[model samples]
Target: MTVAIVGAGAAGAAIAYALRDADADVTVFEKSRGVCGRAATRRKEGCRYDYGANYVKDDDERVTRLLTEELDTNGLVEVEEPVWTFDSAGEISPGRDSDERKWTYEDGITQLAKRLFAATDATVQRETRVETVAREEGRWSLADAADTVLGSFDTVVLTPPAPQTAELLAAMAWDDDRRVAAHDAVAAVDYASVFTAVLHYPFTLDRSWYALIDTDGEHPVGWLAREELKPGHVPEGESLLVAQMGHDWSGDRIDDDRDQVLREAVGHVAELLDDDRFAAPDWTDRQGWRYALPDGGVTGDAHRSTEDAGLYFAGDWVAGEARVHAALRNGFAVGERIVEARNAKTY
Candidate 1:
């Protein structure tokens, strides 16, 4: 049997990883040049930073074991400092202490997917955007935007954001009520927008916490983190701050001029940190995630009803959480279900 997984993000990668020992051929399609989706990483001028997701916390035991025991842990690093909290009024306070482990790669957070894909025999096709999915004669067919046939598979799993997945289902040629139900359920999952600003300074910053999050969600900057806390990310005596603007603020200026957005983010960061140096970063970068975080999950029965038709969905939205661990867990569940179905048919 053959399986085609769309969007090589954390969920997609986890699905492939879970099916590594299964008796099926798995092919993953990714629209971008790189994988890991929102848990992204980039390097610039000898500094590596995770601009999309700061780090993955050990919220799930399965994911924790996968990272520490199952996978190669060579470059794995943990943040020692705690996360502080701030309010809309810019009043900073010490957050509650917790023993949660924050994990990331010394190279960057993207290594999570890269490592997962490396351990599997699955084929990863980068820069391949699967535009259409069609079911014909009990098999599934995928095509590109220009109607170029990619391949036919026995099963297809979609791991894109809820909106993108809904769009794909809407365009698919499968005329089944399950498809419509899945589409509606997936479409109803709302997302929160986030605009990230990477600010770099030539000097170091003295701070006790690794990150500061907006507790009430009313601040312009929802999250601010020091990339230097992650080993091998920033050079000594230098600092890099990852500022993620609040959902409301990001949605409002998502399409604004890039320079203007960066300026406003820098100003907000400076005021929040009470440091004028933060306002004048020596270098900067920015990214706009229109569908950064999902607010809700799809109706389980609606999506599960399509599984019998060799169509499945897995992602953060499907798991009803915006965390990377949740996405990985959901992918594992979906992949295991597919394997079980295949085994049952053989018996």
Candidate 2:
């Protein structure tokens, strides 16, 4: 069997790794240059920081074992600091006191997907965007932006966000009710926009907690985390802060100038920490996620509907939460389902 996966994030990588030992030829397509979609990391001038997801929390035993035992390569470490929350009024307080363990790699969170991909035989084709998919005689065919044929596969899994998946399906000329139903259900899954500003300072910042979250939605800032807390993320004697604007604020100025967004983020962090020095930074970087995360996952009906056409959906969106662990879990489950389906065909 031949398999083609779109989006080489956690979910897609998990699926490919699970099928590595199987009698299948797997290929993964990722539009971006790197993997681990939102659980992204950026580096500059000997400094690295996770500007997307801060870290991965091990809530599921399987995920725990995967990180702790299976993929326990070098540099896997736990974050000891607790997460604290701040209100719209800028009052900082203790947040969730869960005993769950948070895990990250010294290189970056993108190492997770990189490790998974390395453990698999799947060919990861980065900077390749799968534009269309077609089904013919029980086999699946895919194309790129210029309508060039990629390949025909026994199965194809899509791991992009719900909205993107829906758009792709809708644009395709599939006449099955399953495709329509799946597209509609996935289209219904709304997403929250997020604007992130990465600020680098000349001096190290002193903070009681690793990160500060806004408990109340009355503030322009949604989250602020000192990336230097993760050790190795910042150069010694320097600091890096990742500030994310609230959904409302992000949606409003998602297309605004990067300078304006950085200015607002600096002001919010300055007020929150009561430090006037935040007004200036040694350097800055920015990224805007239009579909940062889905508000909710697709319904069971929507999931099953896509399966009718040798199509599978996997992502944090399918797990109803925008977390790395959830996406991995979903990916594992979807991979198992594909393996079973392939075996059934053989019989």
Candidate 3:
């Protein structure tokens, strides 16, 4: 069987890794140059920090095994500090979550996808944006922006966000009811906006916890994490902070001027941290995510619409959770389902 996967993010990469030993030809297409999507990292001035997802939690044993045993490339390390929470008033307190170990790579979180892809024989084509998918004679073919046919496959898995997937399916010329239903169901997936700012200082910052979260939902800043706490992320005598704006604030200023946003974000961070020096970082960077987190997962009725057609969907939202672990779980389940379907076709 030949398989083609769109979006080489966590879910897509995990699916490809699972099928590495299976007797199938797999090809992955990624629109961006990097992998792991929102679980992204940035490197600057000898500092490597995660600007998107801070770290991965070991909430699922399967994911834990994959990180520690299966995909272990000597870069997986545990975070020793606890995550603290605070309100808009800057009153810090202990977090309510379990004492599970937090995980990250010495290089970056994107290493997870890189390692997974490396373990597979799949051909990953970067910078390939699949515009539409058409089904013909029980096979699926992908087309790019210029209407060029990428490839035809026995199975196609989509791992992009729900809205993007809906757009792709809606563009198909086929008149199958399953396609229309999938488009409608996926189109309804809602997401939250997030604006992140990465700041670097030449001096050291002494903080007890690795990160702080605004639990009351009343602060302009939703989260603030010290990237230097992660080993090898920051050079000695230097500090890096990743500050994320709240949903309302992010949505309001997402399109604002970059300088204006950065100035306001630094001010907000300074006030939140009770340090005037935070207002003036040695270097700074920013990113705005329109679909940072999914509000809710698509209903199962919608998921069932494409199952019989050998069209599978996997992502953090597919499992009704906005965590890295959920995406891995969804990928594993979808890969297994696809393998089963392929075997049935051979018989």
Candidate 4:
């Protein structure tokens, strides 16, 4: 059997890992130069920061075991500090912390995908954008944006964001009601936009919390975290703050000039933290996530209707939660389903 997975994000990586020992050939396609999709990381000025999804939470038992036992724990670190809360008025308070374990590598959160793909024999093609997925005579074929045929496979798993998945389905050369249904259902999934600003300072911040969240979802700055809280992320006597603007704020300014966005973000951070020193940063970086978080999961069984046809979908959107663990767990479930189907010789 052969399988092709699209988007080398957490879900795609997890699926490939789960099928590593299976009697099948698997290939993964990623558009970016790196993997892990929104669980992204970057290094600048000797500071490493997770500018996307932050860290994975110990919300699922299976995922916890997979991280702690299955994968290498060499650089694994747990964030000891708690997360506090803020309001629309920029009033800060404490009390939303939990016993949930927030896990990330000393390098960054992207290590999750790196570690998973490392354990798999699957061929991961980076900087390769799969623009087409067509069904051909009981099999699937994929093509790049240049119309170059990649390969043919017995099964295809799509782990991109729902909007992109919907586009692929709409353009696929398949004549089935299930295709239309899946496209419609996948297209209907709403997503939230986020604009993240990375600010660097020459001084450190003394705070009891690892991060701060907007409890009412009415604040311009939705989340602010100190990168130094994560081990090996930032140097001593220095601070790096990741400020993610709220959905409305992000959607409004996502297309504006980058410099303007960074300046405004700095002002917002200063106001939120009640520190005039934050008004000016030694250095700054920014990333705009147009489809940062899924508002809800896909509706109806359209996604499952085509599974018997050797097509599958996995991601946070499919799992109904915008978390890395949810995407990974869903990928594991989908992989197990495919393995079971193969065992039964159903496909």
Candidate 5:
């Protein structure tokens, strides 16, 4: 079986990793230059920051087991650090104030996908934007912007967020009630936009573990982190903060003036943290995530799933969505379903 996976993030990588040992031929296609999709990282000047998922968690049992096994072979460590949760009220919930949080990786979280992608013929196409996926003959057609053909494969496993997936599927004219339902699920997969400001500070923060604030504050940065603790991602002593701004605020602003967004973010964060002397760092960068998390997360109905079948889909939005662990489990389950379907077809 030759399988083509779209959107090479946690979902894509995990499926590839699970199927790499199989006899089937797998090709992982990524539109971006590097894998990691939302779990992405960026480097500028002399500072490094995690622009996407700042951390990989073992929140679920299966995810814990999978990561634990992978950690044995890969260079992942366990940090007992705690993470704080805050609200728009400017009130504070000091996380890991007494201890550290659980974390892994010697490099950035993207390393996990890189490791998975390295073993098989599943090459990731960076800087390659997928124009459309049209069914041609018995196989599938993947096209680029010029309407040129990229490749033909027996199956396609897509892992893009709901909205993007819907657009792609609609372009293919692959309209089934189920398919349309999958597209609708993306809209129902309620999420908010986020603006993350990554700055390198000379000193550490008030909390070693980032704080989640809530106190009638307009700025609700989901949570704050020291950045130093997120192994292999940031420097040893420098400070980095990613503020998950309110969706309404982030949506209206990020598309217009990014620098203005940054300045305003820094100023708002300073107020929430109760620090007047807080000044912007010499080096600063920003990132925006539109489909950050949903209100109810992924469930069987909320996320699309097909066992080892054609035209499958999975992401953080499936079965316990938004969490790193849930995403991993979705990948594992989808891969198994695919493998099973292939076996059945062979028999």
Candidate 6:
């Protein structure tokens, strides 16, 4: 069967890879230039910025095994920075003292998706946005923005956010009940918006990540990551700091003057260290994720389609929380369901 995976992230890639050796053909459609949806990366000048997920960790042994390849323990660093929290009252330090492990992309977060995408025969079409989808004669017809007929397939698997999936299905009125039900399920979670600033410095901070003071600043900054500590992320004697602006500030200043955002970020870092000598980055930019991450991820109903057989829907959003493991778990569930449906049909 020709199965279409509507994303190239962890869940989509996992589905494709699982079905690769199975009795099915997989075709993955990615809206971006490459995989790594939330775990994305950007290249600017000579440096690569991990604006999305900085790291991933899992207690699941199988997943840990899958992601731990091609790198060593030295490739992943333990975050020892004592996180300091500040409110209008005063300050609080919730330190991390356990053996907590946060895994980063030895190169950048994009490597995770790249590795997964490479495992399957799935055709990843970048910059190809699905404009519409419809069902005809038990097959799915998907069209792109240019009015080109993308072709028909037996199964359509969507791995984008629940809201986005619902929007397309709603716009097409494809499955009114399923669409409405999907929205109800998706509305359960709130997504936080984050803005990051990548700063290149002349020296390293000797720490993999730094805990910044999250005070009452207009989009108070979260952790300040020294990217140089991540293997292959930076050169010697150079530092890369990634600062995260809180959701409230990001929402308020979503369209604020670009200069204002950068300046505010730099100032926050300066205040955190009480230093003026720390040079502002020679490069600065920002990105907005409409559904950057779920305030909480809740499992929605993942079952047979209301209109067609063998069709399935899965995504990280189902987990009611955001993380690499959540995507992996969701993909596994999707695979299990597909197998069950296929087996039932054969009987």
lDDT of 1 by residue, 11-88 (tens): 999999999999789999999999999999999988999999888999999999999999999999999899999998
Please report the TM-score between candidate 6 and the true structure.
0.86
The candidate, 3 or 4, that scores higher on TM-score is 4
Q: Scored by CA lDDT, what does every candidate get? A: 0.94, 0.86, 0.87, 0.94, 0.69, 0.67
Q: How many backbone clashes does candidate 2 have?
A: 0
Which 10 successive residues of model 6 have the least lDDT summed? Answer: 70-79
Q: What is the Å distance of residue 93 in model 5 from its true position?
A: 3.6
Task: Judge candidate 1 at residue 163 and give its lDDT.
Answer: 94
* Every model: Cα RMSD to truth: 1.0, 1.3, 1.3, 0.8, 3.0, 3.4
Q: Show how many residue pairs clash in every candidate, following the order shown.
A: 0, 0, 0, 0, 24, 5
Of candidate 2, the 10-residue stretch with the lowest lDDT total is 300-309
Q: Model 2, 187: alpha-carbon shift in Å?
A: 0.3
> Which regions of candidate 5 deviate over 4 angstroms?
71-74, 95-101, 175-178, 206-208, 213-218, 231-237, 297-309
| Whole-model lDDT, model 2 | 0.86
Tell me the tens digit of each residue's lDDT in model 5 across 1-347: 88888889888888887787777788777887888688876766555556667667656676666666653446675545566556566766654344323554666667667766776567677777787987666567888889888888777887887667767766774544655565566555566677887766677775644445343335545455566666655666667766666666777776868888888878777776788645567667787777666556443453344222277777786654676666778888888878877877861
* lDDT-based ranking: 4, 1, 3, 2, 5, 6
**TM-scores vs. true structure, each candidate:** 0.99, 0.97, 0.97, 0.99, 0.87, 0.86
Report the C-alpha lDDT of model 4 over 61-156, residue by residue, as the tens digit. 999999999999999998889999999999999988988999999999999999999999999999999999999998999999999999999999
TM-score of candidate 5 against the unseen true structure? 0.87
**lDDT winner, 3 or 5:** 3
Off by over 4 Å in 2: none
Q: Candidate 4: TM-score?
A: 0.99
Clashing pairs in 6: 296-320, 297-319, 297-320, 297-321, 298-320
